[model samples]
Target: MDDEILIVDDEHETACHVREGWKVLIVDDEPEVHRITKMTLAQFIFDARPIEFLHAYTGDEAIAIMANESDIALILLDVVMETDNAGLNVVKHVRDVLQNPHVRIVLRTGQPGQAPEDDVVANYDINDYKDKTELTSQKLRTLIRASLRSYRDIRTLEHHRRGLEKVIAASKGIFEKQALKQFAEGTLEQLSALLALEESSLYTLRHNAYELRNSTLETLLSNTVLLVGDDKANPSDVVLEAMRQRQNLYRDNELVIFCNNPRHSLIFHIEGTRPLSQMDTYLLNLFTENIIIALENIRLNELLADNQREIIYRIGEIVETRSKESGLHVKRVALYCELFAKLLGLSDEKAELLKRASPLHDIGKIGIPDAVLHKPGKLDADEWEIMKTHAQIGYDMLSGSDIELFQVASQIALNHHEKWDGSGYPQGLRERNIPLEGRITALVDVFDALGSDRCYKRAWPLDKILTLIREEKGRHFDPDLVDLMLANLEHFLAIRDTYRDEFQGE
Candidate 1:
């Protein structure tokens, strides 16, 4: 018989022992019967594992052992121990009370007439009923071997069932992940659960092809380690060689899986002491195939979102350029809005939304006539009134779109000009009545407009802009926001300097 099972890869091999031992519990009142059973099976080995014997002298003792020990694969239960139906009661407890249907139970009775084979087989959940006198050494060994095989098969099926459920749950989790790092971490978590290992592993991505070529195997592994927790182990020589050759490596205590994509490659290193069965290998392969698909989908979604954001920035630039303002005006304002939103305790998602939507704050100016938009001087009262209508026009153009980005853009376009004191805009909305998105954009827009040179006005000095912002706090901007901007004045100045206009040279 093969002492080890090897999961093979092309030109590379990884092997694991089947497992250690089969735990067999012997329940009986007679010391002689326990002695005889142990002697009979002294040299017995099944499935490449020796037998470990657990003895219980009474039915209660057997129940206690069964309750405490989960790995007992077979029970040689004796009928009429301490009670007439003591062994039968132990079977009932194992099957019904403990709900442990996995352990195989065989009833051995010296008093065959008391518990007949036909009655015992029909009534009790015992695997086999044998008269103690007929159970010789060889017959007992044969019976134990058969019972162990059954136990092994049942445990394998149970493992696969649990593994499938984990795969299903993991698929849902991976699908919900939006970022690459989140997806990779989630994959590591789920893979650990699938293999019944502790969450002490690492995941890595290798992007540079040249690095893979120039670096030694150990150096490559060390450089690409992205997520590592408490449980860390060095990759074995077999594992490193498998990775170098781009193949899966599975050993008794560790597994390394590789996923290749056109843009990059991912490696997952998992460690545990349990040997994986053939079925485990199959299930792991299936789970990894699904994970690769999910990872690719998340990558594609990220690319799509980047494209959409770029298109929005370009559209905002066109509107700004039409009004004779530099496209950099919107870029600076967007960064300012993002920083302000974050300092105000907005979540990462909301801050990103604000960054993407702030550029469209002046999108309404696209609808204004060129004469008013490019006036080169302060707008006359009548012309200013017409230009103000652009806010409502931009809102109408963006509203009613199903896209979430456009919906937020619409709110910023309409309400960014509204005042905290209800004195400004097409809507004259007062303090808190205005959406928070509009409020943030409003402050950032004014800050950028004051510091930037535009068609109508020269850029103000930093000190003059700060004084005006402080003076108009409650009248033009949210009091809290004005305080926050002043507190983090350097951050806004940094953004202004980074995306400065062509005339604002380094």
Candidate 2:
């Protein structure tokens, strides 16, 4: 309502009388125009704000003044100032060049013939055309009111359009579940700008406590935001209910919870004595709807990942069942892989993934015929070849998977039999060429094989098993990893003891 209006006329007393409760800008060829517009509008108050009269003597002066204060809602333009078409040119500047669309322009000319109504209306952007002589005081007031109302509506629409754009832009960043924090921060920034309120005065309704978002507002308001809670020790049930009900309660300055994270969310408070507006409610709901959906998607994605891990564990158990090996052998190997991954300096996430994936290193054995897998003696050539097919079988089972863990597991299953010296099966990938995961699993698998009694072979003594690993060195094992196994031989022995086959006594 404090937004200004402009009046342009040659008569000083008349201009002053017209400039009442509105802030006014006067533009005319005669200096007296400024004085009258101000005097006429002095007594009238539109919305609690008295008219501020800004004076301009000619068309050129009016354009310059308008450029500086483009927010002027209404402009009473004089047509016969300096040139007959001068007012028309100013209208063009305001609409086309300056691009100030919200201000309402009314054309007023002393000489009707010099700038005819028909011609001016057709060519110019002015809202209304009038002759100065026809303007009575009551008629002038009516014109001012109409122009101001149009200006107000236009401004409101503009503010709204900009706010929606901000919301849409912020929503784009909410593609992933974890990105809720980023989206909330962006939504808050745009909302604060659109509402024309101090950012601190805005409070978002979240779980329990309304947390202070803006740094400046947090200190200024002393962290006392809207609270529906019982006591200030922590957020209470009443406070939670108030937020869930979308009720705005301003009793004392206690923070409110607004934006929630995966578990806890961020709450920001807008500090001001003025109550929340309809626009405030509208914007807050818009942001909340977007954030809630984003958080939900994140949780859903995590659940799916966990389900996938469980499936892989089950698949590994199936492979173990194919041989005389205990199902827990797969689980024990998975744990050993994790320990080895950590010793090899893998990140926690990568180590965990390897732990889940490494158990499937023998997954192809599920495809091998039971006669060859559960054979009571060393395999003949044909049976050995059939046994070797397990590697390819395992590879085929896990290949072409979109999942990263399964993809790596497939490669390990295909190549774990290959020796470090390039003398092993399937592809015979040597030393450094072998997938590191396959290499690590090979060591663990062999150690487990030799330390435990298999249906085809007796469990060797720990000393003898260590000597076999030492003998294999670069020829059968990656020497560096071989050293690691030697150092952790007791740990490997312990795993064998822990998940030892129950049927070994038979």
Candidate 3:
């Protein structure tokens, strides 16, 4: 039957280029069958695409080809090859061993008795079974078109499923990101996952929309091109031209996405060897839209946080001024707390939290009467005992709030005066019993208080303050924190100099 087939004209067979086409693998032991099949489909075009035929004469050869090529859309398998069950074995290998459920397989058999149609369809994972005699030129074309359609639809669904999974995974902790650069980098990582591109891409953020210089874009272009070694010093003329016209560019293998707001303009540059499909472009657009909204929310939340910090500091300042201490005391303590938290190996988020919360440590002093708070002479035992109530009072004022910063501040207020050896303050928390935030704020507050002038005492010399701190370690302060402060004494001194009070003299 195969010998009865006529060869296609050379002019028709070699006319069109097979650069872009659905990959079709033909597996049959008979060389004549392979040649006749190619000739019959020489002029066939499905969905505006030509067929790129890969010939594999045996089941083993077909397995090798499938192993190497991932984009094979359809396999035309002959049931009787080297062995009667060769085609059936290949089906098992592709579906079970390779775990490739996307590629469609159609079994063509010269002898239907060897592998019954109903039994093969019911027992194996083959998509369709056909007799060789019934597969004429027209039947072959129809069969291929149906198989390719199924394969294309399956691949499209699989691609979208994978892209959605990546989007969900990448967006996990993005909303909690406090810094713009961190959020931007994380957004880029998610973009990479969405597009299946490499993570090493250049991102440019232009604060001034009017200052879109070619130099900035050129730097990004150079970095991206260099990463892929694309041999171009500048971006493609299309990309440059698109930027000049203020339009987005999506090439087969490159993408330039722009996001703009009143305050900032964000540009993403990604390049790869394969062009993005329409689905990829759609997913990227959706991801970027969500990113813009997320970024706006993050910025607003950051602004709110800044305002809250300022309010807390101002309230602390009012308390300090009433107690005859400089407002700079709170500011310096905040900076010192941040530094100590970092030195103690806390994460950036936790360090910033401590910075914002430490300034309220003396807020309890608001409850102390003016006579004791403003007394110039040494406080008598009664006045001292009355003054100690401020810690409990401050904690009472700020506690019971669901806000995380306030909760932290309440802890600092309650325990900052407590001694490490159970000898100080309202609670007398000893050693590790004190909250870590309290332990940190206690050391910074005392350091700044000793160095700055107050109503009761003149500013002590740096050497005298250090001697006192060293002598009192493990008795008044956490021993490890005291050692850490001493080790990084120069940094603390820098913070003191940076936030010096205008009223240094008593």
Question: Which ten contiguous residues of candidate 2 have the minimum total lDDT?
Answer: 1-10
Model 1, 1-506: lDDT tens digits are 11111111122112354446689999999987777777667666677787899999999999999999987999999999899999999999999999999999999888989899998899888899888777766567778889999998998788778778878998889888776666777777777767652222233321111112223565676565544443344455655766687767787756777765654466676766556657667778888888779868876887888898798889999998897778888888889888988998997778888898888888888889899887767998999899999889989989979988889999999999999999989889999999998888888888888888765567899999999888989999999899999999888899898888755332
Task: Give TM per candidate.
Answer: 0.84, 0.62, 0.79
Give the per-residue lDDT digits (tens) of candidate 3, residues 462-504: 9999999988899999999999999999999999988886554
Best by lDDT: 1
Tell me the TM-score of model 1.
0.84
lDDT by residue (438-477, candidate 2, tens digit) is 8888888887777766655578888888899999999888
Off by over 4 Å in 3: 2-4, 9-23, 27-31, 38-71, 79-99, 111-129, 138-142, 197-248, 251-253, 262-264, 455-457, 504-506
Candidates by TM-score, descending order: 1, 3, 2
In candidate 3, the residue pairs with backbone N, CA or C atoms under 3 Å apart (3 or more residues apart, or in different chains) clash, namely: 252-275
- Where does candidate 1 have its weakest 10-residue lDDT segment? 1-10
Q: What stretches of model 2 exceed 4 Å from their correct place?
A: 1-24, 43-55, 64-70, 134-138, 178-276, 299-303, 321-362, 371-391, 400-506
Q: Please provide the root mean square deviation of candidate 2 (C-alpha atoms, Å).
A: 9.4
Give the count of colliding residue pairs in each prediction.
0, 49, 1
